[model samples]
Structure formats: C-alpha cells, structure tokens
Target: MTKALNEFLESNLKELKDNGLYNEINVVEGANGAEITIDGRKMINLSSNNYLGLATNETLKQAAKSAVDSHGVGAGAVRTINGTLDLHVELEETLAKFKGTEAAIAYQSGFNCNMAAISAVMNKHDAILSDELNHASIIDGCRLSKAKIIRVKHSDMDDLRQKAKEAVESGQYNKVMYITDGVFSMDGDVAKLPEIVEIAEEFGLITYVDDAHGSGVMGKGAGTVKHFGLQDKIDFQIGTLSKAIGVVGGYVAGSQQLIDWLKVASRPFLFSTSLAPGDTKAITEAVQMLMDSTELHDKLWENGDYLKEGLKSLGFDIGHSETPITPCIIGDEKTTQQFSKRLMEEGVYAKSIVFPTVPKGTGRVRNMPTAAHTKEMLDEALKVYEKVGKELGVLS
Candidate 1:
C-alpha cells in the first residue's frame, strides 16, 4: 500500500514538472526591501508587497528591538487565557482609532483573522456574497464559516445587487453578508465602496472589507473605507500588520458588540497563541509613522507612476491598474514564464503569475513598486525590460 501511494505521488509530481508548472523556491539572503540578494547576486526586487517600505524601516526596527528587550519573546498562552499583554491591548486600541471603528481584535495572522472573524459571525444557515476576485484568505474564511457562498462578478455593482436581492428574496438564509477586497491584489483595482454600501443598505446585508493591501496605501494611509468616506457604514474592516505595517498578524475593526462577540466566539482567538511583543510594537510604530507623515506613501506612488509610464512608453501591454501593483500582461502562460526567466537573468526579480492564480491565457509578470525604490533603480529596470521585451518578441 505504501509503495502504491508513493508511486501515485511520484506520477503527479512528474506531471507537474513536465508541464513547467512546478514551482522552485528562491531563498533571499537578507531582509526584504526594494532590492534583494538571491543566490549571492543582488537584484532589483519587484515581487514584494512591502508597499510603504516600512518592513525594514529604522524606526520600526528600533521599536521591535526595544520590545524584545523588555518583553523577552513569545506570548505564553492564547488571548482567551493569560496571553493578552499590554502591547496587544495598546495595538488594538491604536488600530481601532486608525480605522475609526469602535473596537478591534488581533489574531495570529491576517489569514487567521479572516478565518476567525468570518466563522465567528456567520454560519451554515447564513449566505455570503463574495467577490469573484477576492484574495484566497477571504475565500478560505468564507468556506470555513460553512455559509452558502454566492460569487458576484468582480466589482460589478449591478450584478452584486441582483444576486444579493435574489439571495434575500429566497428567505432561506438566516443572514446575508457581502464581502470584498478593498483593493484587489492581482489587478490593483479599487472596489466600488459607495455603490456596494448603497446596495447592502437596500438589501439589509452586512458588509465586510478586507483592506489587507489598501490599509497602509490608500486614503493618505488611513485605508479604503476612509478613502471612500464610508467608515461608519462598513460592518467589519479587516486588515493586516504583515504587509504595509511591516510586521506579522491581522485584525478586524468593527463595532464594540461585534468585537466582544468575536473575543468569546472566534476559535483562533481562543485557541491560538497571541502575537509576539516585537511584532506588536513594530506594528504600532509603523501605524504612528503613517499617521505622522505622507512621505513614504507619496514616494510609493511616485515610483508606481514612474514605472507604469516607462513600461507603457516601451510598447509593453501594461494592464489597467489603479494602484502600484502593475501587471505586464503577456497572454500565453509559457511565454510569460519565459519572459520572467529572462528578466531574472537580466538582474530583475519580478515573478511570472500563470494559470490558476490568474486566468490561463492572461498570465502576467506582476510588479510591486515600493517607496524604497530610487528613480535610478527604476530606469535600470526599465532598460532591462525593453531589452528583454525585444529579445522575447514581446516588443517590436
């Protein structure tokens, strides 16, 4: 039986390798920043989600070190036990204020926050209206909730209204909720919050926004709800400390009642260990920096615009992107993979996104421009892009 199982696994693995679909991991030698060293060679990195360049910021590093000196290391227990430290309380309060919500609760990871928050509130009798293009975390969370899922077309307010209306009219569900990503990660498009809010209100549906990518990038760094001036209307505002905030963990900001219920009901909050002192402190400092100045955020957008314009000028098909996450759309998966390999050989570290992660034909090389990138670095990257494009026949 063991021999048969091993044979089955080997066959599947061989199939993947043969199709060029098997992924090979690359190890980064140091901290993730605008540029990274891989295999002892430094390259201009365009694959990180560290939008505001806070991941390796000096102030955040100092804050983390201080916390480690004071608090030692890990939280000894779960939040429901004795693990809720002063740092955790402080971070939650800070996040509540930042999101303009009444209360907030932190979890082990952004992914866990979704898993905890979604299942804590909605259940099998409930129905979830999710965006087709939402992040994998949101999808997993919704699935965990045991709720009947209804996928609305991506950012289509009319389709959302019709589906939501139909779900409500059925009278079979105990509750209904609409969830979406504030900013879609792959395409960099903003959700139509105003229209979504209006539809939710009309259908009496609870609203949830996972602002993982938008939290430290939009609304002068306040987030997507604040960007649309709809803070008071969104039921749950989910965000991550791992991305722009430069630390690990996630949180859900909402009404005092909702948070109180989650504190008692969420399994992850009750079962999982709390965030470490270092992460809590670093995230707090990052938030303070966002509130203090727009320097980093402005630089991020400046780099984004600069790179986007350069790619367009080179006759490459840069897709429609509202934020800094740009995708160089090369329709064929094999060609896109080849293009990415060539870019790596030329000392640029952009990754190719292929089928399953995206549609099969619309494979792309996604570029995440950060605030730490210099204009000189971008110019060099653009030169390599032009050279690779012509060599690969992607450009005339």
Candidate 2:
C-alpha cells in the first residue's frame, strides 16, 4: 500500500475512535430470531427488522431447502444473459399481485433496487423533490441519477406542494419526481402519502415511495400506499423482501411500461447475476403467506403495542412511533450508548443511534418487537429495562 494512502486512512480512523463514532460489530451465532446469542451469551433481541418473525419461519426454510435441492444455490449469470430463471419470473409476478400493481421487477438487494430504479427513469434533465428524512439508499440513488435534488421538509405536505409548484411553473426541467419513505425507519412514522399523492396529481409530478419498512408492517402487509388506497396513483412502489418477508431481495412494482424499461435499462439487473433460486422461491412462499392471511401481521402489531405500552407505563420517552419500532430516547450521545450497553449486559440487545444516524443530542435506543417474541420474553425484557432505567436515572 502507498504510504500517503495509509496515513490518510489512519488519520480518519483515529478521528472516528477519538470522537466515539466507531461502531463495534457484534457477532450473532445461530439464526436471527426473537432471541439471539452473541459472544457466548443469549440475549433478548430487539435490534432486528424481522417484523413478522418470518426470517426463520419453518415454511420459508422448507421452501428454500426444496428449491436448493432441485435448482442448486446460484443463478449462473445476469438476467439479460439467461440467468432469468422461471423462478425469477414467478417471483416478480407474485410480487406484482401482492403489491396490487400491473407488473414488477426484482433486484439483488433493496439498496440495489433503489439505485437501479431511480437512475433508470431519472437523468440530468430531471429534478427530484425528496423528503428530508428519506432513507440513505434513496438519497444515494437520487444522487446517482444525476438529477437536481430539492429537499422538502419531512412529511410537510405544504412545503412539498410549494416546491413542486415552483419546479413545475419554472419549467427548469423535463420532469420532476417526488420521493419519500413510506415509513421513516428512525421515527417509525408513516408518510403522509395521501396528501403527497394529491399534490403530485395536481402538479403532474412522478411519485415514488420506498416502502421497505412498511411492506410487512403496514396495510395488513400490503403496505402504506395500499393502506391509503392510492396504489394506482403512485408511479413507483419500492419494497424489500429482507425485512418482513424474512428472505432477501427488492423490487419495484409499477406499470408494465416501467417494469419493461427497468428490465432493459437498470444496470444492476442487466449486468449483475440474478437472485439465487432458493432465495427466489423462499421469497415467493413468504409473499404468498402474507397474502393468505393477516395472522402474523396482527401478532406483530399486538407485540408492538404491548412493548410500547410497557415502556410508556414505566415513564420512558418512547417517541412518536406509529409502528412496531420503539425508540427509548436519551438526550446525550454517550449516555444513550451507555444505556444500550447496560441493557445488553443485563440480557437485552438494543443498539443506540446517535449523531449522523440520528440528530446529535437526541440519541436513542431503538427496539423492534416481532411476532415471534413471546409475552414472557417481552416481560422479562421490560423488567430489565425498569432496573436499568432506574439505575441510570432515566426513570424515577
């Protein structure tokens, strides 16, 4: 390695360590579920995004194993070069039906889906009006599109309308697109998509909603757009199979024309190898299960409510979460991290968010309660929370 490059990297890493911004990754042994084992200790897990508890579902695992036995483990090449197996086609078709869209296209990952879809339709001649609180992937995808990006206030419909009106009236670009997360992950707040759709219609702007978190948690697992009954009104419906479906992949559901264009133009789908057959089959089975019933979805919400109410009764500031995600807010960064550390030591595993991930001085420990978590598990976690909170002076 070059000496200059080594020095630059060392300096940056030193700064991160000095500032307490360095992340220490914990190794989880065994499958991720309602509980997990880390470093030879079992802990009540609250850091996962497995909303419906399907990640280790017996049905999904069986489907994956069956597919692996028949089709092997990998897709040999990119979709355009014959890697597009019948499994892929079936997965996309299932996704479209589940999403109530005309058609859909799948990608290797959620991040890849955002990068591929945004750049496929947007270019330098276009402008994208993005929510200030949109996910990092959406931000990166917009940047990669080479489009002029304008930030609208978070979930502020009036601001979006004004900016959209100006962009349209000014005629500074060929097209203007508005994009936002269907559910803001950090705060667990659902987007004001109805008002947004109304504004998009009046302004003739393209609409995009990244429903990664909302897909398995909202609208009986149909998602935020369907929750608002505006599926046909939105131009792009992006979702992930990893979070709630308990598998791995992402997709964009839209008009047939849009799916067709993405298939031909999206670089990741065109050049990168397709999703493995096992993953594809597993995702298909998961989506089918989601469509078949709302049992898992309801259980997830029940657990969320149980946790939220438990924390609230204990006088902890849980923030304004409208979903299963729970945030125990602690102002200072170091204190918040310390609280999280203490929780882990006491047999709970919740991660702290500070600074760049969330605003400085507004740090928090986020909890994700899933359908798989038993009442006994949540009660035990709560008892630990109470003990830790009192010791830290977070609760009286």
Candidate 3:
C-alpha cells in the first residue's frame, strides 16, 4: 500500500479506538435463534433481526434442502442472463401477493435493493425528499441516484409538507420522490405514511417505502403499508427477505409496469448475480407461512411489549419504540459499549449502537425481542438487565 494510504488508515483506526466508536463483531457459534452462543457462552439473544424466528425454522430448513437437491445450489447467472430460477419467480409472486401489489422483483440484498431501485427511477434531473433518520443504505442509494436530495426531519409531517410544497412549487426538477422506512430501526418509530402519501399525491411525487424492519412485524404480518391500508397509494414497496423472512434477499413490489421497468433498468438486477436457489425457496416458504398465519407476529408483539415493560420498570430509558425494537439509551459512547459488554457477561447478547449508527452521545443498546423467545427467557434477560443497569449507575 502507498505510504499516504497507510498513514490515513492508521490515524482513522486510532481515532475510532480512542473515541470508542470502533465496533467489535461477535461470531455466532451456531444457528442464530432466541438464544445465541458467542465466545463459547450461551446467552439470551436480544440483537438479531429474525423477528419471526424463521431463520432456523425446520420448515424453512427443509425447503432450502429440497431446493438445493433439485436446483443444485446456485442460480448460475443474473436475472436477465438466465439466472432466474423457478424458485425466484415463485418468491417474487408470493411477495407481490403478500404486499397486495400487482408484481414484484427480488434483489441480492436490501442494501443493493435501495441502490438498484432509487437509481433506476430517479436521476440528476429529479429530486428526492428523504427522512433524516433513514438507514445508511437509503442515504447511499440517494447519493447514487445523482438526484437533488432534500433531507426531511424525522417523521415531522409538517416539515415534510413544507418541504414538499417548496420542492414542487419551485419546479426546479422534472420528477420528485418521497422515501422513508416503514419502521425506523434505531428508535423503533413508525413512519407517518398516511400523511406522506397525501404530500406525495399533492406534489405529484413518487412514493417509496423500504420496509426492511417492518415486514412480518406490522399490518398483521403484511407490513406498514397494509397496517394503514395504503397498498395502492405507495408506488414502490421495498422489503428484505433477510429480516422477518429469516433468509437472504430484498424485493420491490409495485405495479406490473414498475416491475417490468426494474427488470430492464435496475443495474443490480442486470449486473449482480441472482439470489441463491436455496435461499429463494426458503424465503418463499417463510413468506407463505407469514401469510397463512399470524401466530408468530402476535407472539413477537407480546414479547416486545413484555420486554419493554420490564426495561422501563427497571428504570432504563428504553426509547420510544413502536415495535419490538427496544433501545436502552446510554448518553456516552464508551459507557454504552461497556453496558453492552456487561450484559454479555451477565448472559445477554444485546449489542451497542454508538456514533454513525446513531447520533453521537445518544448511544444505546438496541434489543430486538422476537417471537422465538419464551417468557422464561425474557424474565432471565430482564434480571440480567437489572444487574447491569444498576452496576453501570444507569438506574437508581
């Protein structure tokens, strides 16, 4: 490496370490479920996005095994280049039906799904109004689009309305779009989609919702759009098969025209390899399970509520989370990391969120309570939380 590049890397690494901003990832020993084994210690897991606990579900496992047996493991090419498998087509169709859209297209992952969809529709000639607290993928995707980006305050509908009015009346761009997450992952807040839809309609703007954390958790397991009955109002409904579906992939559900355009215009779909055959089939089975019953969804909400109540009762400042996502705010970055470490020592595996992932000084230990957790597990986790919170002086 060049000397200049070496120096830059060393300085940045030092800065991150000094500021307690560097992340240390823990490797899971086996299947990631309600309980995870990390560093040879079994602990109650509170940090996974497997909301429905379908990642290790026997049904999904068998589906993947069966697909691998028949389809031979890989898709062999990109979607437009004969990579499309029968399993891929079936997954997209199930996604569309579940989201109440006419058609859907899958991508390799959620990050690239945003990259593919945003850039495919918008360009330098257009503008996009995005929520300030939107995920990193959304920010990167907007940058890739080369469109004029207008940062809207987080869920401030009034601010959104004012910005929409200005961007529309200015007539500075040919087309505009408003984008948000169905559920804010960090704070666990739900987006004001109804108001957003009104603003988009008034301004003739496109609507895109990336429900990566909301699918299979909201709208009776359909998502935020269906929770409010706005399936037809939103133009692009994007989701991740990795989260609730507990597999790997992302998708965009919309009208047939939009789907057709993406199949042709989306760069990732045309360039990147398609999702693996086994994963596609497994994702289809998971989505089908979600549609067939709400047992897992209901249980997830119940556990979420139970955990939240326990955390709050213990005097931890769990943030205003509308979903199963719970954030225990710790004001300092190092302290937050320390708290998470202490939790691990006490038999819990909730991770810390520091600068960049969340605003500096608002560091937190975000907990994701899934349906796979039993009441006994939650109780034990809460006991650990009490011990750690008191030891850290985060509670009275």
How many clashing pairs per prediction, in order? 0, 0, 0
Tell me the lDDT of model 3 at 57.
Answer: 100
Write down the TM-score for model 2: 0.98
Ranking by TM-score: 3, 2, 1
User: For residues 207-324, what per-residue lDDT tens digits would candidate 3 score against the true structure?
Assistant: 9999999999999999999999999999999999899989998999999999999999999999988999889999999999999999999999999999999999988898889999
lDDT accuracy of residue 263 in candidate 3: 94
lDDT by residue for model 2 (175-229), tens: 9999999998888999998899889999999999999999988999999998999
lDDT of each: 0.92, 0.93, 0.95
Candidate 1 per-residue lDDT, tens place, 1-396, comes to 699999999999898667656666889999999999999989999999899888999999999999999987887899888999999999999999999999999888889989999999999999999999998999999999999999999999999999999999999999999999998888888999999999999999999999999998999898999999999999999999888887889999999999999999999999988999998999988988888898988999999999999999999888889998899998888788889989999999999887678877998999999999999999999999999999999999
Alpha-carbon lDDT of model 1: 0.92
Ranking by lDDT: 3, 2, 1
C-alpha RMSD of each candidate structure in angstroms: 1.1, 1.0, 0.7
Q: Who is ahead in lDDT, 1 or 3?
A: 3
Top candidate on lDDT is 3
Task: Please give the distance, in angstroms, between residue 298's alpha carbon in candidate 1 and its true position after superposition.
Answer: 0.9
Off by over 4 Å in 3: none
